[model samples]
Target: MSERVDLWNNGNLVQDIFLGEIKVPVKVLRNDSFQAWYLLQPRENGNKSSKTDDLGSLRLNICYTEDCVLPSEYYTSLRNLLLKSSDVQPISASAAYILSEVCRDKYDAVLPLVRLLLHHQKLVPFVAAVAELDLKDTQEANTIFRGNSLATRCVDEMMKIVGKHYLKVTLKPVIDEICESPKPCEIDPIKLKEGDNVEINMENLRYYVDKVFREIVRSSISCPTLMCDVFYSLRHLAAKRFPNDPHVQYSAVSSFVFLRFFAVAVVSPHTFHLRPHHPDAQTSRTLTLISKAIQTLGSWGSLNKTKLSSFKETFMCEFFKTFQEDTFTESVKKFLDDVSSTESKEPSGVSEPVHLKEGEMYKRAQGRTRIGKKNFKKRWFCLTSREFTYHKQQDKEPIFTIPIKNILAVEKLDESSFNKKNMFQVLHGEKPLYIQANNCVEASEWIEALCRVTRCNQKRLSFYHPSAFLNGNWLCCKATAESTEGCARCTADVPADTQIEIDGDRETERIYSLFTINRSKLQKLEEACGSIAVYQGPRKEPDDYSNFTIEDSVATFHTLQQIIDIVEKLNESHEKYQKKRSSSAKYGSEENPIVGKVS
Candidate 1:
């Protein structure tokens, strides 16, 4: 239940001339007309739209007509009184009060209401009062008055008009204080102190590290440049905390790589830095730390395979890319080679292949593996002619018979040609699988050939228009038929009954099937002329059968039957001659039978 009462602002109810000096209290009938008086009504507790309340009584009661004038004259006097109140009087104060009370809990409405009051010059003082009340509790502003565009605008406008003196002087000062705190800076490594200190903030380390890591994850930092700093940091932290513990060293390195990878590659791009770094004295200390981290990682055996595998999965590309440079590549190769050399004597399946140095190529020859693993050898390739060439170490001669599937796509190399120093990248959609190429052109050609041989075998794609094929474009698709050297029409032979209609201007020819009866004939013509390599000459038209149709009279007569009988006889004669020739080739020497065709 609710009620609304409209009260005019001017004077008291009893003594004012508007009501002609009426008494304070009086009762009136529930349904009285008021044509000659200033009618007043009391607030009630029921829906105004309802004719009667649940108790079967009218909700509102009015005073009857009396010796009274309208209240408009009193309202005019009230305005004059407001004008005389102060330099900035509270005119329309009642309306402003009602608006504030209604919107007290809904803070977003305060701005619009204040703006509305701004248009009315008499209500400035009332509006200023509301603003002062709001600014009294800063916490309330935070809780209820959200800082959106409108709120900001309202605050700015209020401050401009009312000045800071009318409100809390500390509000603007506190906001400035917040803006003064330093934001995170670019390229500044987090200041990590060595020992656990009494008063240092633990969250600052995490906050700054996370900020830096996010940049790394997003590739804001290049792998080559940041790997040293990131890996060195891990090693330093481990050495400082765990001293000589080998397990701790390995765990630290692995976790460090994962965190850096997530930050630099998986986080926001702009937050990271990928600027190039030349090998210089400035970053010597960081580079030394990275080498130590690698050495720590190398000390692990089978016990740490799980964590090491995760590290490998996440940063294998980063590792490989780092390994390609001169300073890091040799060290990585030596480490892997050392590992391989140690496992050679022991019966540990087959040793992992040593990562060879760039510019060096290894060809696999035929050989059987020592029995411990199911697959004696997993296949790999050597970079040759920009693309990779497969070689099984056991094979005497190279054979390009094995099929490689699941190719993601060919990657362009940075260098101009397939040489010793070109860059290449081929992602296989798997985390740890990639093929490097020497150059782009060879990659393109190789990938095209690979697709041709290894396209999905179960389904066939429909023929695509020749215009759709661009010189270097490639994609996976379902083909309906396989034809390597010719158009789809030549590959899928039409039957003898199908007719081919050729259409085009004088310079070109377009071929299409007209009827089933002439297809075989057209196919024979194509085969005889070698399919007109470019259809260079003017287009030729076949004899038109536009008006050819069997007449109904001829079809009902005996002459039609005679024509069909003769055609059947001629077909039988050809069949017999073919059989006789085949029998002669099978039984006698290579010779044709029924030379005269009498049989």
Candidate 2:
């Protein structure tokens, strides 16, 4: 009798008949075929009632015919399947072999797959597969690694594998890109000459270096080999770029120091799992690099000797002591504490208010503003009770001062067609000073503070003509808003109005009278009123001054009289209390003669 066996035909089960116990081999007619061969044995009980015990299945060679190549999409599908399986199941050797073959034979076809694997954080498996092949040692691999964005994505992985070789290949290119980019320093390189001021582009360089080091830090968390490689690469490149020029070298080192790489490492030791024995060599190597960087700074001539000396005396000395003890966290913390303490001890701005007069109060605010159409320059402005002075740097003399009393108005400006924001105009007589804040909120705060101290309310000044004093055009002259046209109606030509002058003087006197009260007397009167309020006890309600007429002189006079009465009552009570205390002391001494003996 013949029995039928099942076989997969186009992924569907189909039956094949065998005439005898001897098996017949089947031939695949298609160019590509999938074959699964298996052996079946009788059950242990030896019952041959059509059921058999299956041992295991074997995946036979699934080969494509000559002139037929596997579709590129098939490789992609296989790669994705392998990556998906890597999450839950270990990828079989057969699957890894297929991927390695694809990568080696059709490298371009598998590049996208490799990138996808890297992006999905399946780098370990991908690298394992690549390791099985000759890809790493190939010229094509290096070209692909260097030419594409994959370098950045897999920099850490590559570093773990290639170490300094990867850094050596990539560092120069990054530095070159940074050097060629638009820098914060506005130096024209073509016109630059010897002895001319050559700004180091510190900001742009810092940004570039920060990005590189951040990637290095992220990679170092998993691969400790990156720590030494990255630092060595940076130090080597810096030396190569600046050779014997300590000034440029100092700038490069300063930029790196500003990144606070060591501080970040110390603060996030857990992230890197940076233990002495865990990553034995890397731990010592990282500390050595940090120490070397700091020591290099001490030897730089570009840094201010006085400031550097102070830093050495404080941060460097403490850092080295703790660093030697392997207390990295404490070392960083102490260094930061010393830095903060030193900064806090200094004046808030570039310079102290060196010329502040007695009884005058001042506040320092730091901001940048355009001066006479040039680029915006940072300035430290000191606003006093009566004047505003600005300095270029700390310890420098004031470059300009404007009397706050002379300020006619301060108006917030709207963003124009350009994307400019947080701008305001300060008007003094007929001249306008345009200033800008970092943001709208900062501008609003400055406006509020200036109005309060200068006593020039924006609301009251809003009624004045918008262009009254713009570009030196005066309202008194009835000149055109454009100063170029000149004043057509000069006040000097007209006869003096005696009545107007008298009215102005009387108004000024009235305003001055509001501030003429002695502040010390007012303080005493306030204390007296507070005492009276306490002595009266909690009443049903207190008098509401909300409805009081602001312009009523009679009402003001009555309020002043009430305050005087309260002060007089408080003085009388104080005098009586003093007399009572003296009498009590005398009576106590007479009553207790033994107390005086003890004393």
> Which portions of model 1 miss their true places by more than 4 Å?
1-243, 260-439, 443-599
TM-score of each: 0.15, 0.18
lDDT of 2 by residue, 52-75 (tens): 434333345556432211223323
lDDT for model 2: 0.35
The global C-alpha lDDT for each of the candidates, from Candidate 1 onward, is: 0.29, 0.35
lDDT of 1 by residue, 1-599 (tens): 22222332234422111111111233333235322233343223231322323222222334653211122332232233222322322221232232222232334334434333333333334433433333233242112222332222333343333322211221223222212342221122233235434123323323333333222222211122112222333334444454555444334334323322232221211122211111122122222233333333333332233434544333332232322334232332232322222111111122432221122222212222121233123344543212334445533344432212333323332232222232233323322122334455444444343332222211222232121111232111323222232133211111111212311111010000111123343233323233233333655675232112112222212222332333344345446666766776744344442343344
Model 2 clash count equals 2
The alpha-carbon deviation from the true structure for residue 367 of candidate 2, after best TM-score superposition, in angstroms, is: 20
Best candidate, lDDT: 2
Candidate 1 C-alpha error for residue 86, in Å: 77
